[model samples]
Target: MPELIAPEAHRHAAWLQAHREWGPGAHEDGFGLLHDDEVDSPDGFAAWVARLRSSSGPDRCTYRWIIEGEQVLGGIALRHSYSELVREAGHIGYGIRPSARRRGVATWALGRMLDEARAAGLARVLIVCAAENAASARTIECQGGVLEEIRATEFGPARRYWIDLDTR
Candidate 1:
């Protein structure tokens, strides 16, 4: 089976260091629209680390995606109860290294998380993405996500999709 391991905390420093595509200050280049402009320093990454480790934080379950023993992707997560905010800000977030896109890594990683959610007693899931992001929308739909509603927001309009795991 393909493995989807949560990243080790000890590796965040190194992982952030090795990744430029989604690293600090990356949003300036259009690669990270979700990241705000202030998160561009080592201190910023450190703060991010702390947030991910906090049980109360939506970024708490954040993980790095690895394949064949190599870290090739990044993911940020929130509990199912946080669907409203998640559908607007962060439902399921992932970024495959530039060299790794289109290789099925994102789809596989998301599936693993969905399974995790199911085991945690979540009956349904809401996954949202930029309406224009066909790739992301495809990934969610492939996992049985059905279009629910679209919301207009300050950042941009988002498409909200639902996946009823109980029915699956």
Candidate 2:
């Protein structure tokens, strides 16, 4: 079974490999915000994770690896709270490994992330995705997400959905 594990130094190689799969800049699609130029080694990546964990910023969140054993299939970030940016961005963000795409990894990871959200006392959670992302829209719907609105943001047109943990 795939589980979400806390970010650790040892998984750096797999994480880097996934980043390289997406090429440069593309990995910024929710794959660790740490710049590749700054993280030359696993230790450096660990330091970066530590910094994010310690920050008092809007991006502050607990990022975890979506793993089945040692392989890093992807990652999911569960934010502690919603900031102005997070309200727009979301309480959670996820990225799937190139090799693991289209096989239900994202859907499963999201289901698990909702468990985390509920545990954090969030009665309902907001999730947003690009309007053009059909797969993401499907995933959110499968998880009982209700369409809230289509809003324009700096990122582009986005679909915002709300999932009620208490009801479903």
Candidate 3:
């Protein structure tokens, strides 16, 4: 495997554009983002770039993963800290390009993110996925996530899971 890296968000624009994925009503590429499409539009893309450059406080780290050289395989984001909103939705969310799904990218990317979270002083973390998304659930489980509950949310039905980095 190539090195797991953190590229400046500005340096990720073309990769982001080329790797976007649309999954059902949700764009898989947009999985962890609050407003993914906005970042893909003209003015929106510019604004997104500016946000990335100036991101601070709990927003300091965002990474674009590359494989075998320059191929932008996928990415992972680390919130320095999570608010109530994130505790319920999961601290990290990721998407492999459609072409990269099922080849263990998410598992690897997520495991890496968990390590980062642990290094940042998190002893345990919550990771939620849509209830119907078996693949996501499996990935979480594979990483030692304990299923805590399955419930309805404003965002629809979701499964709440927690992983203890201390044990992993």
Candidate 4:
């Protein structure tokens, strides 16, 4: 079974394997990876992990990795508060390694993150995915996500959804 874990330096090798699978880019959403984040070196990776660990405040994000045994499968993140950025990116962001897609990894991670959101006192959460991402839409819908609208973002057109926690 896959389990959610905090980002840690000890998992660097496994994490790198998964990262490489995603190819080169800042597109690994749930890891909280920034364009400038230096995750290729031990020191830089540790620093990045530390930054993720320190983001416990209400306005920050909490990140978790999906791991089954020693293999890192994917990541999920829950933003603790709403912001202009959240309006576009949503309160949660996630990505499953290509090898792990279609395995219910994202749905499981989203459900876990929803519990985290509820514990943090959010009554609802906004989740937006690429307008053409049908798999993500189905996953969100399975969790009771109601579509709001499709809007153009800096990245592209995205399907916005709101999941009411009270109904979950």
Candidate 5:
């Protein structure tokens, strides 16, 4: 079974394998990777992991990797606070490695993150995906997401949905 685990340096090799599957880019959403993050070197990767571990405060984000044994299947992030960035990007972001798509990885990981949100005392969470991302929309819907709108953002038009934790 796949489980969410904190980012650890020991998994650098496995994480790199999964990162390669996404090709070159900062598009691996849930890993909390920034554009300037240099994860290629062991020292740089450890620094990146430390940054993730040290995240705190009102705008804190919790990142978890979807792993089954030693293999990384994907990742998910639960934003613990509200902010302008959260308003646009939503409270949670996730991405499954291409090779792991079509399975229930995203849905399962999302459900787990919802639990985290609830524990953080959030009444609801905003999840946004590119309007054309039918797969992500469906995963959100499966978890009882209600569409709020499709709005324009810097990234493009995105479908916004709210999952009411009280109803979950």
Candidate 6:
């Protein structure tokens, strides 16, 4: 079964394999947290995760791996607050390994991320997807996301959503 766990060094090899499978910039749609150059080294990957874990501000963030024990299926990053730039970037961002897509991992990981948001005292979280990302839009909807607006950004048009966690 898939589960979300805090990022750790033991899963570096699995992350590397996943990144290689997706090639370059494939997962950047939602997962802009880990860059290829940064995670190419074990030490760098560790430092990257550490930096992500220690991040602060309106865009303060934390990330976790979607795993089944030793295998890393994907990841989710939750930003606690939003800066002007983050307003366009969204709050919860996620991605699944290429092999892991279309198997409910994104939905499952997103649900787990919502729980994290609730624990963090967030009443609601914003999620945005490229207008063309039907897969991501569906995943966001599955988690109770409501359409807020379609906004133009530097990247292109994005659909913004707000998911209320107060019910939980």
| Estimated TM-score for each candidate | 0.73, 0.89, 0.77, 0.97, 0.98, 0.89
**TM-score of structure candidate 5:** 0.98
Off by over 4 Å in 2: 35-37, 52-60
lDDT of prediction 6: 0.80
Question: lDDT at 89 for candidate 6?
Answer: 73
CA lDDT of each prediction against the hidden true structure: 0.61, 0.78, 0.68, 0.93, 0.95, 0.80
**Poorest stretch of ten by lDDT in candidate 5:** 77-86
TM-score of 6: 0.89
- Report model 2's TM-score to 2 decimal places: 0.89
Q: What are the root-mean-square deviations of the candidates from the true structure over C-alphas?
A: 4.3, 2.2, 3.3, 0.9, 0.7, 2.0
- Model 4, 16-111: lDDT tens digits are 999999999988979999999999999999999999999966569999999999999999999888888798899999999999999999999999
lDDT of 2 by residue, 1-168 (tens): 788887777677877777777677645444457544455576677887676456555455767778887778888877767778568977777888778889898999999889988987888888888899889899889999999999999989999999999998
Q: Which ten-residue region of model 6 has the weakest summed lDDT?
A: 28-37
Looking at candidate 4, the ten consecutive residues that score lowest on lDDT are 53-62
lDDT of 5 by residue, 1-168 (tens): 999999999899999999999999889889999999999999999999999988999789999999999999999998988899789999999999999999999999999999999998999999999999999999999999999999999889999999999999
Q: List the residue pairs that clash in candidate 3.
A: none
What is the Å distance of residue 70 in model 2 from its true position? 2.2
Please give the lDDT score for candidate 3: 0.68
Instruction: Name the better of 2 and 6 by TM-score.
Output: 6
Residue-wise lDDT of candidate 6 within 12-91, one digit each (tens)? 89878877887876454334454453887889888877775677765678778788867778878888876665588788
* Leading candidate by TM-score: 5
Ranking by lDDT: 5, 4, 6, 2, 3, 1
* Number of clashing residue pairs, candidate 6: 0
Task: Please report the candidate that would top lDDT against the real structure.
Answer: 5
Error of 5 at 137 (Å): 0.1
- True-vs-predicted CA distance for residue 153, candidate 6, Å: 1.4
Q: How big is the RMSD of model 2?
A: 2.2
